[model samples]
Target: MARKKHTEMSFLDHLEELRWLLIRSTIAIIIVAGACYFIDDYIFNTIIFGPKDPNFITYRFFCGVTHFFGVDDTYACATEFKFIIQNTEVGGQFSIYLWMLVTAGFILGFPYILWEFWRFISPALYEKERKKAALFIIVSSILFFIGVLFGYFVVVPLSINFFATFQASSDIVNQFTIDSYISMIKTSLIASGLVFEMPIIIYFLTKLGLVTPVFLRKYRRAAIVIILILAAIVTPPDIPSQIIVSIPMLILYEASIIISALVVKKQEQNG
Candidate 1:
């Protein structure tokens, strides 16, 4: 592909610049993570355990929906979940702290990371395109944070509650290890943030001619099925939960379609 030139920096020089970009990004994450380790109380009790509590915003919202529909069997309305998280290994707590801080750092440093990514790509874009990348970073960062919030508030709570309550035999008790719980939440947050980059992904794909409006339109049904399956994998296997998760993704898919169309049009104009 032909690339626009910013009129500076050789290939090796660019790599050197990239190395510094990475160094800065890493430094930012470590600084934020250090703060996270200190504020373990807020991170653990308020943010991490917030979903474990029945008063989570998702449960309350769904409970209200069920009440409005006059279907009174809304289990989400319950004020308590019957489950215990236990650490069977001595190192489990330490592992959870380590991973939790790492994930926290990633979330906190997302914007800086995006900025570094932009710095790498911007030189290859037109001056106008480079200027627009400021909006890209801002939008990408906001979408990621929104996805993190959604995962924490909706997906994590539902999955934990469902798994804890699931009982095929009376002989089994629901005792999740601290590491296991942290892993679940961490996966949810990271996966959600990555998935929410739909429009940006599509923009690049469009630029490379890898995706187009017609292709997306033709595969619309297949995309929906794939999205539902992905939703099921990420959230509890319940239909409502999957649908709720898939809705935002579908909206983002549509947004990606629009973004792809715009990029394609711009390319055609330049050509």
Candidate 2:
């Protein structure tokens, strides 16, 4: 059947289109998740549990950096973690496995999801704007993947290093539940991925007249404060770690402002 024009579609039709879009996106995630099951061991052991090990690549890199700088901090150069991950519930491991499979699926299948979303929205866009669908998907996916990596490599390690070694008393021991560990990992990866889409989000919001470059500039200080707070929340409570996390986010905010400006300029030119 031929697709109806946007103007010809009723509210119910638009809702139906959105429903199918979600259905297709869900199916794509499930398909990718099925493939992820094959590498479950690697995902659980190497990727998820890697940060718990003191010898993980991120820790080693930081250790090397500290050595080069002659820093006396043993936190970076530690050879072991003080915490143990345990699953108290019989089905906890199974539940976590399924959750991670879906998470991995969504991350890997992000571009396809974007394609489906674009197709749904493309009908409402001008021909020239719709032509940029591939660019949008590519850039969005790249940014998301980069953000995931940042979360995994930079944020996760710092968090694990801090919490794993924190000592309230010599009598108390830290035994983290598997559920909590996976929850942290999931939140970090997903949050970072979404945060990195700031520029793309700003671009669309600008086009929709909801945001402006002047507004972003005027509230630059507020944005910076919020970014720092977010950085502190995600990273270890250290100046260096917070700075490391905040820098990329600050750069993205500035870039969003520029993108918003260009979008407004183009809209004005067309008008």
Candidate 3:
């Protein structure tokens, strides 16, 4: 069935379309999550718990870097964490397992989710703009996955390492709940992925005349402060870790300015 023109579609018609979009996206997620059940062991033991291991690749890489730089007695060289993860609630682990399945499903099913979203909005876009759906989905998904990897490899490890080692006193032992651990991991991955969509976001804002290159430039200093604050919130309270997170976001902000400029230039040409 052909979609009605935006002007022809009634408000209920738009709502009906949105309803189907959500339904389809949810089904996609559920299917992907169901497939994940078969590999639950690998998901839990290898991927989810991997960061806690001293020999995790991220830790090993950092350790190697510190070793090459002749750093002595750094936490990077530690063989074990002082904390143990505990599940106080009887159903805590089960609850975490279900939540992780949904998270993994959403991550893996992101492209399809984007497709569904595009389908919802494309009816309102010009034909030329609608034609760019594939490009938009591809680029957005790539950026999102890269951010997720960065969060996993950089943010999560640094956070876990810092919390594991940090102590106010020798008498206070550190014990983390499974729920808290999973929450940190989920927040880091999802937040980073969303942050990486700044360019895509700016492009649309530009198209809508809500943002401009000059505006982005004028606020660059403020954006930097906000980015640093976000980095500090997600990463460990250390300068190096914050720097590591900030660099990519700073780059993305610059890219957003460029994108906004191009969009405005195109609009001017059309006019």
Candidate 4:
């Protein structure tokens, strides 16, 4: 069946469509979240708190890298870090469980959410463009999951290790609240997931003639500075952590430029 072109939708009609789109997306998320609630214990203990262990995959990989370089085991190679996590408020643990379920739901249902969003916007696009929905959802979901994994396996581990090991004095013990720990994980995962949407964002901006590859290239230096700042903000304060985070973001920016250029070329050819 062919999709009907919606070239004559009124403002209220558009609003109504948007409302349904949001409603459907929210329903999908809630359904997934309901499932997540049942497995909250495993998710929280095994997955969310995995990075706190010194023997996490990320730590082992870094340790191996340091060994290959024949460097002293003071930096990434050192893995002996101990920290305790506590819940201060009465409902803190329950709140964390609920929020984690919601977050997991969002992550798991991301592709469906994208599908609904694409459906909502497709009528505004050309028939040829409407056919690209599958590609859009697949690529976007892949990028988002990659970003989530990077955050979980790299950023979160490095951050936990750094903070766990770093001490102002021997008298002070690091007892992080459950809220703080979960907040850091949530921020890392969500922020990286969104950051990895750079290409998609660039495509839309280019389509709207609000951005160009030339413009991106011209501000490449400034962009690097901003990336570094963002990296610093997201990851641990150390240079290595910042560099690790910044490298991927820089790559994403460069990829966005290429994507924007391709979009412009295609637009020109079509016009």
Candidate 5:
């Protein structure tokens, strides 16, 4: 019997395949989230609240750097800050917990999700390209996890330290809502994770002829400006923090250019 070609599948068949993919992905997330729910203590107190503490690893690392550089009167070396994270709404904490579980589930099940996503798209690719499913998942997952670590360690600590210590007057206290704090964490992690996928995005765009290395190089300066703006938005309103955040992004952009060039080269060779 002859194997059916991917183009032979009807629109309904595609929809049915998509439905199953969604079902499988959702079930994977739910199962992981269910396990995360049982570890509420660790999730809430340790991971979630860790950056709030002056003794957190990120804070300590920065403090060490500041001390090593002999920087005086900097927030990095400060041992503590005055702030209270309160749940103003009755369901605020509960909502945060649920969201945390879902976030954890997504992070942990990201590889599986990527695999399922690749499965959906692989049918349209050549057999040689289809063989790259494992490479695609591995590289994407590594980039995502690196982004998460960067957000949690660098961006989160910088923002938390800056905001927790900033004040208009001595009389004004920093009382952040629980939801607000969680939102900061979520935004940092998710945004950075997505940002780190720029190279992969560029690869696909290049493959589809939507983007070229020449175009990227031509607009490189504009991209740098935009990246700085994003860094400032995510991090504290300080030059150093923004620079630190922007550096990785600039590196990602450069990497993306290389990836795009390589893709174009491969296409040229094949053609």
Candidate 6:
């Protein structure tokens, strides 16, 4: 293919560039996915099932905290968790392997994917803007991983414990489908990771003059309501769990407001 001149590239040229970027990003994901496939036994047995065990670190820590508080009546003193996952289809295991690998690919290749996105957009931006955006891919990638960990270790375990132990009818047993269990884990991690990037998202929106600090502040009460709703949705229906989930998100909202304000100030100076 003939390369377009640097100063004469058309919209189609840009689209062609984007095509290569995606191809490279997909290659990176496959490399990481292959590694994940090899270590999937450890990943599935350890990290994925870690929360289902009573000896999970979170449970132990919660037990210790309850002891330190001299509260003896809580369910945190449990010795073993009482839930089992059952695969209901003949090809379920094979399907799960494929799904897990793809998810791992997306997670591990996130930084490269972000780089591709940046590359596709950077040519249209000013040098100053490009410099600012260069670090965005890195920062956002880190925040996403951190958020995934937080969700997997903190929120997912808590939810599993609560729902696993809660009894609705004396005759009903809790034998959860493997697909359902895995879906919950995947959803929690991915959702929280994206939620944790609010400040970064807000910064870019501010740069584009799309969101303002005043707009965030003016809807403070409304934001609070929405945060609470999200908290209830992602977390178990307990006051402490809801509060724990909400605090970080609420903090993100405040940080977004600050970031937006700074971006606005910088824009004013430049204008």
Number of clashing residue pairs in every model? Answer: 0, 0, 0, 0, 0, 0
Model 1 whole-model lDDT (C-alpha atoms): 0.86
lDDT of each: 0.86, 0.92, 0.92, 0.90, 0.90, 0.86
RMSD to truth, every model: 2.3, 2.7, 2.4, 2.1, 2.3, 3.7
Q: Write the per-residue lDDT of candidate 1 for residues 118-209, one digit (tens) a residue.
A: 98888767777787877999999999998888788778988976787677898987788887888899999989988999888888888778
Per-residue error for 202 in candidate 6, Å, reads 0.2
Q: TM-score for candidate 3, please give it.
A: 0.95
Residues 155-237, model 2: lDDT tens digits: 99989998888788989999999999999999999999999999999998998899999999999999999999999999879
Judged by TM-score relative to the true structure, which candidate is superior, 4 or 6? Answer: 4
Q: Kindly list the per-residue Cα lDDT of model 3 for residues 1-271, writing each as its tens digit.
A: 2434656778999899999999999999999999999999998999889999988998899899998998975787678988999999999989999999999999999999999999888887888788899999999999999999999998999998888988999999999999999999999999999999999999998988899999999999999999999999998898888998999999999999999999999888978
Pull out the clashing pairs in model 1: none
Clashing pairs in 4: none
Can you write out model 6's per-residue Cα lDDT over 1-271, one digit (the tens) per residue?
Answer: 1223347679899889888998898888888989898899988999888899988988888889989998883577677667789999999978987888888888888888888888787766676667766578879998899999989888998899788888798788899988989899989999999999898899878877788999999998999999999989999898888898999899989999999999899878978
Task: For model 6, give the 10-residue run with minimal summed lDDT.
Answer: 1-10
lDDT score at residue 70, model 1, on the 0-100 scale: 89
As a TM-score, model 5 comes out at 0.94
Query: For model 1, what is the alpha-carbon lDDT of residue 212?
Result: 97
TM-score of each: 0.92, 0.95, 0.95, 0.95, 0.94, 0.91
Using lDDT as the yardstick, the better of models 3 and 6 is: 3
